[model samples]
Target: MLLACSGVLAAPTSVSAVSADGGSRITQVKVYPGSATVERTARVPAGARSLTIRCLSPQLDVQSLQVQADAHVRIGESSVKVQDRDLDKECATPLDDQVRDAEDRVASAKAETDSLELATSYLRTVATVPPSEPHSGPGTPGSASINGTTDTLRRSSQDLLLKLHQSKRRQEAAELALKELTEERNRIAGPKARTSTVTITLASDREGELRLSYQLRGPGWSPSYRAALDSTSGVVKFERLALVAQNTGEDWRNVQLALSTGQPTRSTAGRLPGPWTINVAPAEQFTTEIRAMPAPAPVAASKVTLMSMGDRGAETTPAMPNFDVQVSDDAYATEFTVPQRITVPSGGQRITLSLGSLDARAQLVSRTSPGVEPAAYLIAQLSALPGVWPAAPVALYRDGAYVGQGRLDNNSDELSRTGLSFGRDERVVVTAEPQQQNSGSAGFTGANVERKVQHAYRVESRHQRPIALQVLDAAPVSQNEQIDVVSQYDPLPADKAWNRRPGLILWSETLAPGSSLRFTAAHTLRYPKDARLQESK
Candidate 1:
């Protein structure tokens, strides 16, 4: 007995165990368009000759892993690989124990229900049994005794029935509790049981720190904007925000978060030029094919011009929480390092972060295109910033009320103004009549055909406050040398050159309350009767 006891207590020989190294904790995260970079740090023990650090996540990009350490620590070989891990190992929490307890209670409740059902059935049979003899004359001792027994049996049956009903209700409550607990457990523990592991080996002479950085593919951020314009104050309040999302299978808790406009997944190197080859086609065959093809569609010569007119304006907003972000700007990219630590859970949920706000100078202008839309649109002209402004979705607001949503065009490396259109301004009224055209022969032999058209527009401002108004109109452009096109404007337009769009005329004026304005445009064209004028594209 003594020998057996000693043998049981002795340690086993050739015991094999695989121990994982202490992993590092994430400290910094930089999110990009479709990927993110994670940085972690770990402390090495003093005088440790060898140390290992494990970094694990489900969306880790193994190829982009990098490591660094202090002077006293030297990084050795590192490896990254995907492995299957028990979901319970990482996801199990106190909720699991609670779920088990609830399941046990359900089983207990069902057992009690079964026992109560049996007792109720026995009581029912006893209550149903008829008296042995027929009822004697009333007030007889036999009748009185029988009545007492029957009353006692009926009361007992009712009590059993009530207990049975309570037992069923308890069972139902237990079942409901079990179902809720099960769902909670499933939610806490995700659907997958696999993750990735990154292992790094190092040698250190004294206590030091190790840093690991790697790219992940499952985290990203997008830009959103809010612009509020107060026409009365002539101020525009612009707020830039970011919507960040991540599901890297690892919660980023208390980690420094940074957002960048750069796209890491896109090619970084300059594009390589391919060989330019020219092949001479068979002239006859090409000509034949071209002739057989259908004639190209004719395009209209009408032109519509959109112009912005405004200066900067004051900004107004609620006081913003301090986010001491260090902004770094370069020709290639811009980065903002958030000062505060952020927490993002490991699910595809978005968290909004305030990037910053701008109080750009702006001006309100009412624009009308009577030929297209009779209603006048209230527009705000905002001066462009020096840096790159990536295209994003913007929500427009006017006078503390939401107007509509618009898209911000990409204006990187360009010095230009941005225009935001609020809903139609009912204070301004506009009307346009249909244009009239006449064609007739002209010149000596009647070889030339002349065309003339007239356009007329009327606008009125009914606003209590004075407003700046712009009316846009256009005329046909001549594309053929033989076609001579001339335009005449009543009360010459402010800018006839129409810098970007030819044949477009703009009229700018300041209108007082309850004022009206009218304008007209006349165009004439002359060309050979046999030749058709080509339309301007």
Candidate 2:
């Protein structure tokens, strides 16, 4: 018995669809400084032999496209082709519809205007034409009839002319609308499409999922931070955030996003050492000529010049921590994985994502340089974290109130601490005064000239609580061997040569409420009468 199935079986054919469909989604994104790697997963139907991923962003790096599938599936050759027609089709639909609608309105308006023009012409001709027969006496019926016809024609012509003007105005308005619509369509659709197609062939015994990933340009992210310091608790809440933006021509909807510190655009290979050569210059002998200098009387010393240093109250407690990303550290880079799926639309708008927060130990102190500014600023000494923190703008807060902004310097590998100034502390008052400057000859045979200057500073703390204050001052540093410089401080400074800067000193003290402190710095310079110091000023 020969039995056949009623319905004929059809051969399997390749199916193509834009990756924007529900079957495909951005699974992971690794963003660098100027570009990003996007991974997408697409579901393939069973018994499918081939599939085409359509409408990929033209900005995608074709060489970086990669594909993977289940073990049972045999992946075949993949290709990328620019689909110019597809782009035109994608952008033409709505714009074409609008243009067509506007054109139709314009046509209708022109037709109405033409009809009014014809009616006006007919009435004008009738009013201007002579009577068909010679008029009899004025009181005759024929003359009266002709006169009535002429009056009717004149009134109708005026009415038609008014309508003609109205119709012309309507037609002009419709034409203007059509022109605007055409310009808009041209702006949106452009001359050509910027889209491509990525086709991959696969042979699978059973159904399996496929994933395609590619690196694309025009997407990037940068790190930003918010540092809130609670002076009472001596803790600084440091929050890491990311400002991510993309203009990849396609929206990333409900996708897992990741930010990486590694710059893929940089060279991956280790730099090879180049040849080094050294050359020496020939030596030349020089002769010096000396002339007798006139002996002059000692001049009166000038007044000591005091060097001037080169230069929000809100009570909103930040809501409890709501960090929504996880951080992973690899050998070469740090990755921040967003915990929830997010939608980042195309265009260059930035989406801020909270990476994490940490409470770092911080010491609060008031700092002042009376020679530069009399006001004292609230400063914080923050301990460094394990990972490298890229230099970024830090928003500062003190005691749950907005204070100011500071910068975190993470440019050095050996940086273990950061000092940030919140804002000026008006409660502490400081004043500096220069006392005396004396210059005269000293040493054996009066060969050396001595210059001495004195300065004094007083600081008063009016805060209700005890506060730590640091005062900074600088003394002249002699760069010449003939010039000898020495300094005397009334109260020993906490740090001499602060931050490895010569002649910089810091005086630290703890002041009780309504307490005052005084300090004095005396600088003495001795040099030969004929020699001048390079950096004496």
Candidate 3:
């Protein structure tokens, strides 16, 4: 008697599943801008890492799913918004489902091929065996009949072999099915591992408030959030959480927590803030936290003055150019003039050109009448006063060259003997000296200026990999003049100067113009990423 075939008799199928069944059934869900949801049950095996449920109805479109450990939830029905009919054409089908289906088909085809091979081999061996004979040869009665039976058995065996060969040909057709399935799977699964993304964009506000927001998406699902508010004034401050969560689950539960509103730390809101921190936590696990409100920057106010003009002693009818000098926080000053054509033509005059207050801190610049464009001049009184020193060293750098310190000519004996001056069209920069005062100053520093002036050469390297470069000196060194070396790009404070010392090593007492000073700075050039997983350009 033949046994009836059951569904189980067809083939052995293994189902991989996700964990935890949901108490909620996501039915009739709609996303405002071209999004959809679908629900369906999946038969998943126990202790599986993940399980994807399929949508039964073609009318339903699924954008994403939320699966917890140990649960296989399916799409019941989906409500999708078709904003543009064009989008519907492109986003009409669920690509992920296609990929999964393709993978399954490929596996099934491989299994079929193996089974067919076995059957073909067994049939070939059977055909080669001679059929058993139940005949008494020679004088035995009905021996002729026994020979005929043998012949019939042999023909049947040959037919069976032919059928086995046909089955093998059928397996070849199955390969095409496998290939199609694989292509579909690839189309669905975009080539990258999913990760939670948090973007801290600085929003524009006249009040100088810091606004932050977050958005997240994953397999079978999508979610978004936004938070905005002003931070307090100081080196650092904290603010309240302000985030809104949206659920995009069909049959599974969707939960979200505002971990930290503005976490400035490497760890979660719970961790301490550091100089370097890159990652943020999931939005669902923590409350919105805003910390360390940065302080507002100070405005720079500077002033310049002409302290003295030598005694204008001359004939009663001496002549001078129209002198206009005005002094104020504004660029205002006063002017005076002596009648033209009168000259004493005697000893050099000592002019006391007082332009600034001794106690006030401000920048000073000047211009003289007759426009002779003095070859060199110095501020003697200003140099003597220590309070007037700029935050950074100020030098008369003209035409890519430094002025000699020996040329400083200061006549004022009040403050100090030191003085500063400039030639025609030359800039006398009273710059704040470059120094890592607090190790956290954001403004221009000495090291920063040095780095900018230093030459940079590109070195090719592998992406995301560390690279190192050796420093070498190629030029003679100097003493009166100074040279500093530095590297930019995730550089540490210690790396500011290599070997716990400055990068510079003096080649001589002075490095004149055209002298070459060389040092190597190593950096890795990142390679382009794999196109499949990257955001579409």
Best by TM-score: 1
For TM-score, candidate 1 versus 3, the one ahead is 1
Local error of candidate 2 at residue 283 (angstroms): 12
Candidate 2: residue 314 Cα off by (Å)? 37
Scored by lDDT, model 2 comes in at 0.70
On lDDT, who's better, 2 or 3?
2
**Residues 1-537, candidate 2, lDDT per residue (tens digit)?**
000001111124555322222245566767777788988777666566666666566787989999999888778888787656444443234556777898999999999999887776655554554556454454333323555654686686778888889989989999999898776544432335366667777776566778888998757777778988887788888888678877665656656667788777665665454555544544563544444445544433111101011111125643443346777898988887776566665545566777778788877889999978788998887566656577777788888888877777656522232278888999999998767899999997999999998889999999999998899988888777888889999899988888777788889899899999998999999999988556633
TM-score of each: 0.73, 0.72, 0.20
Backbone clash tally for model 2? 0
Please rank every candidate by TM-score, starting with the best: 1, 2, 3
Quantify all predictions' global Cα lDDT against the true fold: 0.69, 0.70, 0.27
Off by over 4 Å in 2: 1-23, 83-193, 205-207, 279-323, 386-388, 410-418
Candidate 3 structure quality by residue, lDDT tens digits, 385-419: 33122122223432334443222222244222222
**What TM-score would you give candidate 3 relative to the actual structure?**
0.20
Best by lDDT: 2
- In model 2, the worst 10-residue window by lDDT is 1-10
